[model samples]
Target: MEQQQIKLVVLDMAGTTVADQHEVEACFAKAARMSGLEASDEAILAAQGLSKRYVFQLFWRAQLGESHPDVETQVDKSYAIFKEVLEAHYQTQPVFPTDGCLKLFSYLKQNNIKIALTTGFYRVVTDIILGRLGWLEGLDENRIGNDDSIIQASIASDEVEHGRPAPLMIQKAMRLLGVTDPKHVINAGDTPSDLQSGNAAGVLLNLGVTNGTHTVEQLIGHPHDALIGSIDEIINLIEGIKQGRPSGKTADAYSF
Candidate 1:
């Protein structure tokens, strides 16, 4: 069977392209503790690629039950704390891109493949990280810029009604980039929700990288066309596809 050409690549931020350093998870845990909510580490990890506010809402409901009267207030409080912590950390702490991220981006650009960054972060924080990494060097407020920009577009969770596990963000990226066929795109991230979103979008390739939040063992059970330890391996995956090799709906590939 011939494989469809991949015209675009949608990437998840934080754990995928950017080194997460467990900072997001740590902030979530700290917010839960400060808010007097009980959430296990696994519970937090499971929602890795979800919206921040939505994650807080889920935690609140899980802790106090869905019908709890103070669920809204608790969610608000926890989310606010989380935002403060996260924003402050990103503002002060150093920002670093994941290994092989720059090389992968350059290769995709050279191949004339469009790149879109989709994240669970809000626009403000997303801009902060992008600016710090110089990814936004040539980007303006519109976010759609020339080849000088590292990425062609950016789609944030809050921009869509529903975030990861919903496929809305990926769909939005496709719409903005003028890509009509989902089969012509590749969605890559480091969390289960990322794979779920890509699958829901019916993309040709749904890739998972272990260098982020989840490890190889943690991501094996999720739906994915390939699994690698670094984003750099994507270069070869696309090359294989262009050579008429199967890049999807087969055994997962682990190339670290």
Candidate 2:
């Protein structure tokens, strides 16, 4: 199949752009242990692409049962512990950008392709993470009045009615970026839901990166236009796709 032309690129934060899964998991485990609750990595991993509030609710429901009394109180206490741990550790062990991310952003910007960001994280948490990573430091001061300006625009879960597997956030990002045709936008993420969102949005290109939580084999079952192990591989794939050159086989052809 011929590659569809891409005009805008939408990126998912957390696992997709930042490399801090281990840190996040450790923080959650510590919080769970402190609360006298057992948290397994598998359970945490399953909630990878969900909002913080939703994640908290999932853990609460899992540990305290579906109809536990004072569920809100317990959830609040657990979340407080989680926040404390995250704040203390996130600053010291911030998430690092994936390899070639800066280069890819620069290349796309130079090529006049609009870049947008969408995340399951709330705006406040997003702000905190970006501040901790110093991601805005490399941008031009004139262009970015504040840290938020580092991105052309963003669609946070807090603003969207439906989260991942809904495509509302992706659609919102495309609209904010003035990308009319879904076929002209490329959605890149690390989860099956991410691919589903893009596919549901009718995006022309859906690129899955194995650098995040999901493996190549997991993404293969989804409708991704291409699959790569790292962000660096994206540039080459995009170039090939643009020139009508075959990049490689589907995700099914590659083992995790």
lDDT of 2 at 182: 86
Candidate 1: which stretches are off by over 4 Å? 1-3, 248-256
RMSD of candidates 1 onward, in order? 2.0, 4.0
Per-residue CA lDDT of candidate 1, range 1-256, in tens? 3347888899999989999988999999999999898889999998899998998888888888999999999988988888888889999999998999999999999988888999999888898898888888666676764666789888888899999899999999889878899988999999999999999999988998898999988887889888887888788778878777766443336432
lDDT of 2: 0.72
- lDDT of each residue in 1-256, candidate 2, tens digit only: 3346667778887777777566677777788789766668888766666665667777788878989997778778877888788767766664678766778877776667767777777665666677766654543422222223446665678788878878998888776666688877778888777888888998766788887888877778888877777765666656756666543333442444
Q: Rate the local accuracy (lDDT) of all candidates.
A: 0.87, 0.72
